[model samples]
Target: MASTLYKWAGLLFLSSFPYIFTLRGDFVFDDTEAIVKNKDVSSESWTDCFYNDFWGTNIKSNLSHKSYRPFTILTFRLNYIMNNRQLSALSFKTTNLFCHILSTVLVWFTYKIVVNIQHLKKHKIDISYFGALLFAVHPIHIEAISGIVGRADLLCGTTFFLAFICYDKAINSQKHSSLFMVVTIILSAVSMLFKENGVTVLGFCLFYDMIHNIKNKKETQIYKFCNKINMKRITILMLSIVFLLYGRWAIMGGTKPEFKATDNPAAFADSFTKVVTHSYIHFLNSLLFVWPQWLCYDWSMGCVPLIQKFLDHRILCPLLMYLYGIFIIRAIFCKQNKKFTKRILLLSVALIILPFLPAANIFYPVGFVIAERVLYIPSAGYCLMISFGLNKIITRFNKYKLGLIAYIILLLIYGLRSWQRSYDWQSEYQLFVNGMLVCPLNAKIHYNIAKVSDARNKTDVALASYKEAIRLYPEYYQAMNNLANLLKNQKKYQDAEYYLRSALKYKQDYPAVWMNLGIVLASTKRLKESEQAYKIALQYRKNYPDCYYNIGNLYLEMKKSENALDNWLKAINFNRKHELAWTNMIALLDNTEQLDRALQLIPNALSELPNSPLINFAVGNIYGKMDRFEEAEKHFLKAISLFDRKVQAIHYANLGVLYHRWKRYDMAEIMYKNALKINPDFKTAIRNLISLQKYKNR
Candidate 1:
C-alpha cells in the first residue's frame, strides 16, 4: 500500500513539475478568442454557454466556429467568477495545470485497470507506472498544458479515462453491471460535451470488450471474436452513442462547420494530392510522438505543402509508417506472443487509433491542419506502447538496470523540452516568435506576430509582418483587413482603401472588413459609400456593436444627429458595456440640450462600465451641463485617474471649462496650461486660456 501511494505521488510530481512554469504564462494564440474576449466565459448569464459556440458566438450563426463545448466554457466561466469577474491568466492556467494533473492520475488508474485485466502480473516491471510516467513528462502535451484554451482537451481526456474505467467495471462486476454501464454512458456524454472527439471513448469501450472476449476464448479466428460477447450491454452502449451523436447533430443545427482552404489545405486539394498529403500528415503526427523536437502552436497556412506528385519525398514517411503499423498488427496476433502481450498491444493500438480518427481528416475537415492539443488523449496510447516496448526490450536483453537508465534519460530529455516549451507560451510574442522559428513559411504565424505587434503599438513591425503574411498567402483576407486598419491609423487612406477592397474580394461576407472599409471610406470623404458599407456590415452581423458604433459615427459625419443617436443607442443595446457607444450617445444628447435625458442614461451605463474612462468623462460633461459642479469635478478627477497611461488633452480642457463656468479663474488657468502641456497645439486649451486671461482682468 505504501509503495502504491509512493508511485502515485511520483506520478503526480512528474506530471506537475515540468508544467510549473505554465502558472506564469499568459493567454496566447486561440486563448485570446476563447477566453479573454469570449463573452460566454465571462458573462454573468452562465446559461449562455448552452446557446453559444466555444468562442461565445451564437452556435447557429454562420460566423460561429461551431465548436460546441458548453461544459468546457462553463469551467472557463467558473474560473472567471473565481477570479473576481476578471480574466486572470494565472487563474485560468492554474485550472489547466490542475486538469492536466488530474488527467495524468486518471491515466495511471486506467492503465492499471488495463494491466490487471490482461493479467500481466508475471512482468517484473510495473508497466502501468511506466506508461503513466511517460505520459506525465511527454513534451507533446505542452500545447495542451501550457495554452490556457486547451482545457477542452484536458477536461475531455479526464472524463474519457473515467468513462473507460467505468466500462471496465461494468464488464467485471455482475452485481452492479447495469449501474456501471449507466455511469459509463453519462461520463461518455460529459466527455463529448467537453470536446467533440471525446465521444470516441465509447468506441474504445466497445473495442476493449471485444478484446476481453477474445482473450477469454483464446481464439484467433475473426468469427469467434463476438461469440461470447454480451449483446445486451453492447446494444445499450451502441444506442447511447447513437443518441449522443443525434443530440450533437441537433445542437449544431445539422450543419457542418465551414472551413477555408487555408485552414486545411489538403482537404481542398485534388483527390490524388489530398490522399498523399493527408497520409503524409499522419506520418508527421506520428513523428511528433516519436521525436517532439520541432513543435509549433499552429501547423496551418502552408506549413505542410501538398504532395502533388507520387514521387514526392514526403510520401515515403507515410509508407514507412503504414509498414510499421502492419508489422505491429502481425506481432500482436503472432502465436509465439503471450495472450497478455497481445491484449496490451491491441488495447494500445485502439487507444492511439480511435481517439485520433476524429482528427485524422478522414471523416471531415478540421479547422487546423495539425493541433498538438488534439493529441492529448491519443498520447496516452502512445505512452503505453512505448512503455510496453521498453519492457520487452529490457526482458529480452536481460538488462533491467541499463533499461532503467535509458528510461530515466528519455524522461529527462522530454521533461526538459516541456519546461523550455512552457517558456515559449509565457507570452504571445514569444510563442509566435518561436513558431516563426519552427515554420517560418507558415502565414498564420506571421499574421499572429502582426496582431501582437499591432496591439503593442509597434506599427512598423506590424505593417511589415502583415505584408509578409499577405505575400505568403495571397487569399489571407484577415491579414489584409488588419493591415488596412494599421494603414488607416497612419492616415494613409488610399493605401488603406486599397487593402480593404482587396480583402473584400476574398471575403465579402466578413463584417469586420466591411466595418473597417466604412471607416476608411468616411475618412476619404465618401460619406454615401461609407454608409452603404456600414449597412452591409450590419447586414452580415446583426448584433455587431462595433459596426453599429461605426454607423453612428458615419451619421454624425453626415450631420444626422437623430440617426447618430439612434445607431449609438442600438450599439449600446447590443453591448451594454460598449463605452464608445454609451459616451457618444450621452454626448449627443448633452449637445442637443437633453441634460435630463443624458443624466437618466448615466446610471445604467455606469453600472455596466464603472471603470470606463470614456463613460466617466461623458458623465462629467453632463453633470457640468446640469450645473452640478461638485459632482462634475469628482467625475472628471475619476476619469483622469482611470485614463492611467496618458490623460487626453480634451478631458483636461473640458474640466478647465467647468472651472471657468464656476468662476475659479486660478484653477481654470492651471487646468488650461496642463491641457496645453499634453498637446502643444492645443486649440481648445489655447482659446480657453486667452478667454480665462480676459475673465481674470474683469
Candidate 2:
C-alpha cells in the first residue's frame, strides 16, 4: 500500500507539472489571431465566446477556414467568465499553467488506469515511470504548456486522456460500468469542442480495443466475449461522433483555398506530392521527440531531398525510420516472443504513434506541418513505451541500484531540457530567436524574427533578416512583398519596385502584393504603371476591398473625383469597415454636389476610426473643404493634438486657413507663425503668413 501510494504521488506530480512553474509570456505564432485579436473570445457574450460561430463566420472567412478543437474555445470562455476577460500576462499565464497541470495529471492517471486494466502487476515498472517523467520534462511540449493561450492544447489533451482512461476502465472491468462509458463519451465530445485534433483519441480507442482482443483471443477467450458484445453499436456510436464533429465542415464546404502558385496548375500536383513527402518529414518530428537532442517550435526543419527517384526513392532519415519500425513490428509479432510483453510494448508504441498520423494529414503538406501542440496526446503513448522499455532493459542488468541511477540521470536530463525549453517560449521574440538556433535553415523562422525586429524599430536588422529569408527561399513571396513595403516606407522606390517585381514573378496573382506595388509605383511618379498594377490586382480578386481603396487614393492624388468615387464605393461595399474608403467616398460625394449624403457618411467614418490621428486629419480637411471654418478649426486642433511635430505642421497650416476664412486675421497670423515654428521649411505656412501681412497692409 505504501509503494502504491508512492506511485500515486508520482502521478499527481506529473499531473500538476503545469501549475508548478508559471511564466507570463507574450503571445507567439497563432496566438495573435486566436486570442489577442479574436473578437468572439474577447466579447462579453457567453454564446459568442464559447460557440464555433466566430470560427465559421469571422476567422474562417478571412483567415483559416478550418475547424479547431472547440474545447480550447470553451476554456478561453471559462477564463473570460472567471476573470471578466481582462488579464495581465501573469493572470493569463497562470490559467495556461493550471490547464497544463490538469492535463499532465490526466496523462499520469490515464497510464495508471491502462496498466491497472492489463493486471500485469510489476511494482518496478520504473521504465514506465521514467517515460511518464520524460513526458513531463520533454522540451518539445513547452510551446503547448508554457504559452498562456495554448490552454486549448492543455484542455483538449486533458479531456482526451480522461475519456481514454474511462474507456479503458469500462472495457476491462468485470462489471463494465455504463457510467464510465457515458462519462468517456461525454469527455470525448468535450475534447472535440476544444480542438479538431482531439477527435484522434477515438481512433486510438478503436484500435486499442481491437488489438487487445486479438492478442487475448486464446488465453482469456476475450475475443469471443467482445464479439458477443454489440461491436456494431460501438462502431456506429464512434461514426456518429465523428460525423457530428466534422459533418459541419463538409456542409460548410471544404477548407480555405490557397491561391495557385505562379499561376501554375502543376503546383497543385507538387502540393499533392508534398503530402507524401511530408509523411517522411513528419516521421522525423516523432524521432526528435523520442531522442529530443534538439527541439524547435518551427516545423520547417531543413533536410536535403534525394534527387534520384521520382516516386519510390526513400529519403535516408525516413528509410532508416521505416526499417526501425519494421524491426519493432517483427520483434513484437515473432512466434518466440513472450505474448504479454509483446502485446504491452506494441500497444504502447501504437498508442504513441498512430493517432498522430491523421493530423499530419500526410497526403497534404501545409506550412509548419509539425508543431509541439500536435504531440500533447501522443506524448502519453511515448512515455508509456519508454517506461516499459526501460524496465525490460533494467531486468537484464539485474543490479537494481545501477539501473535506478541510470533512470534518475535520464529523468534529470529531460527535466533540465524541459526547463530550458520553457524559457524559450516565454514570449514570441524569444521563441523565434531560440527556435532559429535549432532550425536556422527554416525561412519562416528568419521571417518571424524579422517581423519582431521590425516591431522593435530595428529597421536595418529587419531588412537584413528579410533579405536572408528571400536568399534562402526565393519563392518566399510574402517575404519579398514585405521587404518591398519596408523599402517603400524608406523611400527606396526603385529598390521597392525591383523586390515587388520579384514577388510577382513567383506569385503573380497575389492581390495584396499588386496593391502594394501599385502604391509604391504611384509614389515614384509612375502613374500609368501604378494604374496597371492596381487593375491587375482587381482583375484577380474582384472583392479585394483594400486594393480598391488604394486605387481610390491614387485617383484622389490625381484629382480624379469620379474615378476615386467609383473605387471607394466598391471598397466600402466589399468591407463595411473600410473607414478610409468611406471617408474618401464622402469627400468625393461633397465635390460632386452630394453634400447631404457626404455629411451623412461622416458619422460612419468616425465610428470606425474614432479618435484616430489620421481620421481626425481627414475629417479636418473635409470640414475645410465644406467651408465650415469653426468645425474645421475644432477638428484641426484635435488632429494637431494627436500628431507628432512632423505631422502637426500640416494641422497648424490648415487651422491658419480656417482662421483666415472666418476673418480672424490675428488668429490666422498666429496659427501660420506657429506652423512655421513647428517646421522651419513650412512652405504653406510661409505663404499664408505673407498673404495675411499683405492683407493687413491693404
Candidate 3:
C-alpha cells in the first residue's frame, strides 16, 4: 500500500516540478482571443459557452476561429468566475497546469493497465512510472503547459485516458458493468466536448478491443484482424463515432472556407504532391518525440521547407512507411511472445495515429502547417515507446549501469529544458523572441513580436519586425495595416495612406484597414474621402463604435449638427464609456441651450466614466452657467487634480470664466494671468484679464 502511495506521490511531483514557473506566465498566442476578450467566459449565461463557437455567441463572418469546444471553454469560464469575474492570468494559467498534472497521474495508471494485460505480464519494468515521468517533462509540451488555450489538448488527453481505464475495468467486471459502460459513454462525450480531436477516443477503444481479441486468438496480419469481432462492442464504438461526427456537423457548419492562400495549403500543392509533402511533415512532427529540440509555436509555410521534390532531405518517408507497416505486423504476430509486442505496440500506435488523423489536413487544411500543441496527445505514445525501450535495456544488463546512466541523463535534460522553456510563456515578448530564433522564417512569430514592440513604444524595433514579417510572407495584410498605423503615428500621412491602400488591395474584407484609411485620409484633410472610407468600414463591421465616434466628429466639423448628435448617440449606445461621444453630446446640448437635458446626462456619463476629466470639466462649465458657483468649483477642481487629464492653458482660462461670472474679480484676474503664463499668445486669457482689470479698478 505504501509503495503504491509513494509511486503516485512521486509521479505527481515529477510532473509538477518542471511546470512550477507557469504560475508566473502571461497569456500569449491564442490566449488573447480565447480568454482575454471572450465574452462567453465573462458573462452569466452559461449556455453561451456551449451553443456558440470560441469566437462568440453571434459570429457574423467566420474570419476568426469558430471551434465548438464547450467543455474546454467552460473550464476557462469557471476560472474567471472563481477569480471574482475578472480574467486573472494566474488563475487561468493554474487551471491549465492542474490539467497537465491530472493527465500525468492518468498516464501512470493507463501505462499500468498496458503492462498488466494478460499477454504482457512478465516485462515488469514499471513503465507506469517512467512513461508518465517522461510525458510529464517532455519539453515539446511547453506550448500546451505555458499557453492557456492549450488546455483543450490537455482536457482531451485526460478524458481519453479516463475512458480507457474505465473500459478496461468494465470488461473485467462482474457487478455494475452497466454503470461503468454508462460512465465510459459519458466520458466519451466529455472528451469530444473539450476538442474536436476527442473523437480519436473511439479509435483507441476499437483498437484496444481488437488487440485484446487478437492476443487471445493468436492472429498476426492486418487483413486477418478481428476475425471474431464482438458485434456488441463494435456496434457500441461505431455508434459513439457516428454520434460525435453528427453532433459536430450539426453544431459547426461542416468545413469552412479558407480565408487566405496559406489557409488552403493543398491549393499550393498539385494533388499527390501535397499528400506526400503533408506525410513528410507529419513524419517530422512525430520525430520531435525522439529528439524534441528547436520546438516552435508555429510552423506555417515558410518556417519549414516542404518536400516538393521526390528526392529531398525528407527521403526517409518511404522507409518510415515501410517500418510502420512492419511494427504493426510484428506486434500482431507476437512471434517471440515478447511483452512489448502485442499490447504495447498496438496501444502506442493507436495513441500516435488516432489523435493525428483530425489534424493531418489530408482531407482539408487546418489553417496552419504546424503547431506543437496538437502533438500533446501523441506524445503519450512516444513516452510509452521510450519507457519500455529503456525498460528492455534495464532488464538485459543489470550489471552494466549504462542504461541507468542514460536514463538519469535523459531525465535531467528533459526536466531542465522544460523548466527553462516555461519562462518563454512568461510573456508574449519572450515567446516571440525565443520562437524567432528557432524559426526565423515564421511570419506569425515576427508579426507578434512587432505587436509587442509597438505596445512597448519601441517604434523603430516594431517597424523592423513588421517589415521583416512582410518580407517573409508578402501577403500578410494584417501586418501591413499595423505598419500603416506606425507611419500614421509618425505623421507620414502620405506613406501611411499608401500602406493602408495596399492593405485593402491585399485583403478588402478587413474592416480595420478601411477604418485606418479613413483616419489617415482625415489627417490629410480629405473630409469627403474620409467619410466614404468610414461608411465602407461600417458596411463591413456594423458594431464599430470608434468609426461612429469619428464620423460624429467629422459631421460636427462639417456643421451637420443633427447628424453629429445622432452618430454620437449611436457611439454612446455601443460603448457608454466612450468619453469623446459623451463630451460632444454635452457640448452640443450646451450650444443648443438644452442645459437641463445636458445636466441630467452628466450623471449617466459619470456612472460609466467616474474619473473622466472632460466629463467633470464640462459639468463645471454647465453649473457655472446655471450660477451654481460652489458645485462648479468642486467639479472643476476634480478635473484639474487628475494628473493624467492633460491640463492646458484653455482649462485655466475656462476656470477664469467661472470665477469672472461669480464676480470674484481679484481671483478671476489671477486665474487669467496664470492661463496667460502657460500660453503667452492666448487671446482668450488676454481678453479675460483686460476685462477683469476694469472690474477690479471699480
lDDT of each: 0.90, 0.71, 0.81
User: In model 1, where is the ten-residue run with the lowest total lDDT?
Assistant: 220-229
- Please write out the lDDT profile of model 2 over residues 565-598, one tens digit for every residue: 8889899889987767876776567567677777
- Candidate 3 residue-wise lDDT, 1-698, digit = tens: 99989877877887888888888977787899888888887888888877677656443235535577888888988898888888888998888888999998898888888866764555536676878888989987888888888999899889988998887776668696667777887898899889878878777877887766655554444432434335566678789889878877766666463445454354477766677777777777877777777777777747765567767867576468668769777766767756445578778878888888888886657767777888898898889888877776777776336776787789889989889888788888888899899889778789989999999998999999999998988888899999999999999999889888888888897889998898888888898999999999999989889889888888887789889889998999999889989988988888888899898898898899878888888888888889999998888888877634478787788888998888887777877887787898999999989877876788
lDDT of 1 by residue, 1-698 (tens): 99978997998999999988888978788898988888888767879999989998888888877899999999988888988898999998999999999999999999898888766567757888999999999989999988887999999999999999999999989799989999999999999999998999999999898878776664555544454447777888789889999999889899888888888999999999998999999998999998999999999988988899988888899999999999998998799998888888889989999999989999888888889989999999999988988889999999999999989999999999999988898999999999999889899999999999988989999999999999999989999999999999999999999999999998889999999999999998999999999999999999999999999999998999989989999998998888999989888988899887887899999999999889899999999988899999999989999997779889899999999999888888989998998997989899989988986789
Best by lDDT: 1
TM-score order, best first, reads 1, 3, 2
All candidates in order of lDDT, best leading: 1, 3, 2
Q: For model 3, which pairs clash?
A: none
Who is ahead in lDDT, 1 or 3? Answer: 1
Query: For candidate 2, what is the TM-score?
Result: 0.79
If candidate 3 were superposed on the true structure by all CA atoms, what would the RMSD be? 3.8
How well does model 2 score by local distance difference test?
Answer: 0.71
lDDT of 1 at 311: 83
